[model samples]
Target: MNPPIDDRKEYSNNFLSTNSPIYERFSQHTPRCHRGFDLRVWLNNEKNLTRTTCFCPPSFYGDMCQYQNQRISLTIQFRVLSDSWSTLFAIIVSLIDHSKQRIIHSYEQFTYL
Candidate 1:
C-alpha cells in the first residue's frame, strides 16, 4: 500500500493567495500554547520547510495568529535633589487583568541627602 501524500505545499500556497488579511510564517521559536503541537522533534528533523501558522510567539494572539497581544505598560521617573546628590525615583508597573481591571505594582525609593 502507498503512503498518503502530503499536500501541505498546495494548501499553503492557496492560503497565501487568499484575500484573507492573515499572514503565515514558520519559526522554531514559537511560544508555549496549550493548543499547539509539540514541535521538538520537528525542529530537529528538517529546515527546508515552508512558512506556516503553526509557529507563533506568545506575544501574538489571533485565529490566523497575526495580531499582537496587549502588553503590560511600565513607567519610571527619577528626580535629583537640589541640595544634595541624592536620587529619587518611582517605578510603576501596570498590568490589565483578565477581568479588564488595571492592576498596578509600584516601587518607590529615595536616597538621603
Candidate 2:
C-alpha cells in the first residue's frame, strides 16, 4: 500500500517559504523608471512616407525610432548624471525632420548639478 502525499513532508526537515528575503532582493533590482525623448516630424510631401530613427551614445537612453504622419511630434528626454555628484547634469532635446532626414533643432541645458 502507498502512503498519502502529505506523509512525505515528515521525511524532509528543511522547507522553504515564498516570502523569503531572497525573493525581495530579486524584485528590488528590477527596472522601475523609463527615460527617453520626443521628436516632431513634419513631412513636406504628402505621397512620400517618412521614417525617423535616433541613436544614443553611452550614458544616455531614449526613443530613437518613430513614424510620422502629416505633422508628427516626438519627445526625447534622458537623465544625465555625474559620477561624483548625486544630481542631474543636463537635459537634451532634438527636433528632427523625417522627410528631409535631418535635425531641425537641438537644445541642451545644464541648470542643476
Local distance difference test, per candidate?
A: 0.50, 0.52
Q: Which stretches of candidate 2 lie over 4 Å from their true place?
A: 1-3, 8-14, 32-113
Q: Which parts of model 1 have CA positions greater than 4 angstroms off?
A: 1-53, 57-67, 71-82, 98-113
Q: Each model's TM-score, in the order given?
A: 0.27, 0.22
Model 2, residue 23: displacement in angstroms? 1.6
lDDT tens digits, residues 1-113, model 1?
Answer: 64445676666577665354453334334554434433433333466544334455687665445577765565545565677565544443334344655554444443442
Q: Note each model's CA RMSD in angstroms.
A: 13.8, 20.8
